[model samples]
Target: MASEKMEGPSAPAVRRDPYEVLSVSRDSSDQEIKSAYRKLALKYHPDKNVSNPEASELFKEVAYSYSILSDPDKRRHYDTAGFEALEHGAMDMEIDLSNLGTVNTMFAALFSKLGVPIKTTVSATILEEALNGTVTVRPLPLGASFSGKVDKQSAHFFGVTINEQQAQSGIVIRVSSSAQSKFKLLYFEQEANGGYGLALQEDSEKTGKATSAGMYFLHFQVYRMDSAVNALAMAKDPDAAFFKRLEGLQPCEVSELKSGTHIFAVYGDNFFKPASYTIEAMCAKSYEDTTQKLMEIEAQILTKRNDLRQFETEYRKALTQFQEVTNRYSVEKQAVDELLNQREQIHSSFTTVRTVAGHIGASNGGGGSKAHLDDSRTESQSDDGSSDGKDKSNKKRWFNLNLNRSDKKL
Candidate 1:
């Protein structure tokens, strides 16, 4: 009988989305995950809802959720595991209901002893390390973001997978619950490679958001329009090329934003040239004005330089002429100096000869006639140039000396 029951096949395992466990999307920040866990833990704390059995069960469920997410190896396993794999791990060796009551009793003291505000902080420590993740294309939750290691070459993606699970014996397929729009949050990738792309063969999806001038991912579900054109408009996209590329797209519903993990895909088919995408009239005009302004600034800089050069050349020429005049004046002053020196020497010699003759006449006490002396003086005066003319020339020479001294001082 035991063998037959075992052969009857075990119940299908409940697949748990890693994103759902954390109550965040693939793009969620470490802080966001910690915040979500704190809220959930507080709401389901067994001590807070002692009368509610459901709350008790939920408390344990949340504890379990925190347990897995807090570990790196476990989180990775949970992320990649399909429904079957997750179910197999979900199966405990045996059920234990007693742990819940004991865990609650220790919660307060545990928080205090550890100096932790909440259990979320415990997970946050682990999350700081997990930030080294790459892009994930798995289905994300509302306001959740993509979480995975980003690739250098490939575009990022957050995705959803649909599968048909068989539960009953050979029964036909049935539909599962379908999530609605605005179900997932948008996280703009930090330092994203510009634009988007789509791979025909991939199941990954990605969501992007605009933060500041660039893009980054954050936790929170956003309901964006299905049309890329509309999405760009809704975000008030700053990139003209990004908007234009959206216009060129063939209205793909697949490209539409839905509630799940979103990704940024970069495929060759999605590549666009500027001419291919149509841009808003205003945006194009704005670009033109921007370009024109840059050109005008460049022209103004060149014109200023040219004007400065012309002024410099004129100043140099004027300086050369001024220096030449200064040098010529120096030469003229030197010639005047030579003539003045010769006149001074002649006057000094004449004065010396007159003194000698007077001395000799005084010593002889004689005998020379007054008339004779007078005649000698008259003859000497006649041979000399006019006294007034020579006196005026001597005054002119003295003035030239003063002028030359002044020029030297200058």
Candidate 2:
């Protein structure tokens, strides 16, 4: 028996402009676009209009438009080339895992089986827990450390309080796992609602030896994207969803922290094994005095930023040079083509005159045939400084030059 192949969903015959679908202008702000999408999404939600296929389609189109417009790079491409730039698999569809109902989940699974690239986000459960104050948070004083074990997929939270003096000097939190345990170190900012908003997450790096456990250092001026907030925002707006999972920390320089309570989390990364790790919080001023490693890492960060600036400068110069060369080539190519066409016209005229002369000589009973042959030979020699035989060879070479060079080597 042969197996049947499944086909993915086909695109609509007419794809409305994404800006029109979202009911926003091309120059609309990100917040305005987000607001428009949210309004339309709520109105045409599949769960709310289960029987209306039209609403369901509108919902999908709304989501699709948001996916392109929300991303900086994709939106730029779409603006420059329109929908033609997004053909093939250039855009990946993003579906929020948190908001999907049972029916939508089933449809998502079906689409996945049919070979659509669907990017799912992290569940909103942890963020909700923090907002609701349901998660346990232990307090760790400056220069103190705590050791604990977190089950797979679970997290341990620690609160670090900083006073005015400590905030001015800066703070550093470090976490190291035991043996083969792996974990992600997370930092949270307090919201006005007295809840925590996730600010940064750093993946643990392998230290000591190849078989050693993962370690994470949350030093000052080294914060990056907050995945938790991004996920929550995407869930709320739906327009901010991304195709790829956000990973890694971005280098930044911060002078100091505010005087208040900040939270840090250690999340177990292992699937089957629990992670045992130690978390420490210390004032940067004191910590740097004890070890030179922190200073060395800071130096490396500065060096990397300088290197990036230099690379950008070189890239711009090279791009300008390439454009100039391409423009020159286009102009020169047009001139060459015009000259070749004129040469072909002249060759055609000469060939016609030679044929007429041969017919005239035959009609005259070959009386002037010898004179005509001599005249033809003299003309060919004068044209190219070559004899009649060599003239024929040169014409053959010229014809070859006009042949397609698709298979020719450089």
Candidate 3:
């Protein structure tokens, strides 16, 4: 009998390249994988394309790719060994994907470009099947209290997601700064379930308390939306301005520290605090680097302020010159009017002389002393009857016989 073909168990068949399965780079971000799954699902979902059963197969692949890549443990294992290293059935095996809704894939653009072949719903179904977790609904009564210290045990990142059934569209959530700082926080909201989710490892992460006045944490918020979608970016301070962009959805992504009593007013509006709880922390840098960065920023600000002051001085000087020019313009206008009036008077007096000079036939009529009409001007020409008006022409004459005169003033 022919040797039995090397048959395998009903485990997931390993695809050529896990990265190619997800249609992403080897170093793609978690958000990128999630986004890719969503797009692939829409394309290859059986429900989306009834004529294409192949889409479902592609969908299953994308789901599997995202599932294995997203989990840190599984990704590490896959990296070290070939596909066989993971528990055999682990590839196609069913895993819970729902409860991790708390985790958001902020990068929407990267996935659409991954060039995967699948439908979105299929991918979602695959995802929904792969990473499902238990979700607990912790409801608090109106005016209830829930507080405590949440000193994070590690340097990793963590975040909180809140969903209110009543508000099913958009939910704005808050994350406090530190122990003594409360009112300042970073906020996030996603999903039609009215759930809010914040980043655990974001540098802008805050877990402080509210004590006194304006001096507090600053939240760095990035306002963006899928450039193609209407998803709105959270305003930097939520009060700043509305900006939107991104190719997928949730375009804006930045962590800003909250300030003032606003955080308390929103968080404790219905619930109070207790003694201890599951508050999370983020990957903060070593204090030295952070401090040095801040100092650099402060120095840049001072330098910029000095530059502005110099520019202001220059602006003021220009303004003064502008005022002076305006004054000169007014004076010129008055002078022009006076000159016009003087011109009229001179024209009146010289009009007759002008008329009389022409009557002299242009030469003084051979008498060498002709009497022109009207202001009947007298002219002493050369004895030869040539014109003799040279001394009166201002154009060629440079010497002044009388030098001590102070006659011309402008």
Candidate 4:
């Protein structure tokens, strides 16, 4: 009943085991865990205990615990890795409309407007009508089909009765809708009191194919739900009931069904438009008789496979080209790197030569002028004195040799 954001614990609250939080064992069945959560949630619900300051927190903890146990994937992860493996954002808000009072519903609606992802159960009105035998239910026999229009926010119910033999062989109920039709497939089981109770609900999936006339279609496959839990008790806590029912749900196998009438309801989910659809009930044997249609579906599969092969061929060609270009780029890059190294060496040699020349010019312009004058006088003297000329020639030869060595080092 609390209208808070219903998020996981943000602060470091006590990290209790989910099983302990729900007061159930780790090996408990899904139904047992669900029942425990419902009991705790109803007890700690904010609407009933307004004076208790801790009731809201207890309600959130109860919801979070159930969220982990309700999902098989999450439950397995928790069992293996504990709460650290479960992400806080993965916890979704689940509201049970049948269990909530008027005030709680008002608050839930207000919070829903604030963008919380609150998953509500089937409308209490609808469930009540179904229980009272007021909702219209049309009979759909095996190998037969019915077409109808269901208005927005409404549903069309059909009852399919199967005997022990048919139940053993199995059944497959398929529903197809016109282009862009949005609806849900709801399955129900008849109770001992001759009233139908909700069992499972599934959204329509696009068929991914179009007719020759270019009309798209949506398809539905009946999924079986566990009908062991009490429907009357579930109506009191629908959210928990919904999650429990969802666990282990698989495509309908009539062998697992009882020999009685089962209900299939097509509920329109479009915002403003009605849905036009055809519902068909077929035994598994009858379904196998549609050999031509099956072949057509197989042909579509083959075409898709061929298209995949073509894509793979093109992918390989593209990959080969990519590798060739990459190799070319690597070769070109190496050539460019070698040229850059040569250019750098040349630039370095030029810089060293310029530095040496600048030093020589500075020395010559300063006190080196007197030194040059002395060298000239000495050379004149050497010309007059042959012995001195020989000495000066030897010194000039040594200086030339040292300059050549320096240039070689550069």
Off by over 4 Å in 4: 1-66, 76-85, 94-120, 209-255, 287-410
Q: lDDT per residue, candidate 1, 191-244, as tens digits?
A: 233322221121111234211111111111111222333333334444323323
* Candidate 4 clashes between residue pairs 3 or more apart in a chain or in different chains: none
* Residue 331 of model 1, lDDT score: 89
Q: Tell me the TM-score of each prediction against the true structure.
A: 0.20, 0.43, 0.26, 0.51
- Model 2, range 158-237, lDDT digits (tens) per residue? 98898888777677777886564656777766656777655555655556631122122333444344343344434444
Candidate 1, residue 175: lDDT: 11
What lDDT does each candidate get? 0.37, 0.63, 0.39, 0.63
Greater lDDT among 2 and 3 belongs to 2
* Model 2 lDDT on a 0 to 1 scale: 0.63
Once fitted onto the true fold, the runs of candidate 3 whose alpha carbons sit more than 4 angstroms away are 1-14, 92-410
TM-score, predicted candidate 1 vs. hidden true structure: 0.20
lDDT of 2 at 340: 99
Q: Please give, for residues 31-138, the per-residue lDDT of candidate 4 as tens digits.
A: 577657655765676656678978867776787777688777689998997776775543545444445677886676665445333455444456556756789989
Model 3: worst 10 consecutive residues (lDDT sum): 262-271
Winner by TM-score: 4
Clashes (backbone N, CA, C under 3 Å), per candidate, total 42, 0, 53, 0
RMSD of each: 29.0, 21.8, 25.1, 14.6
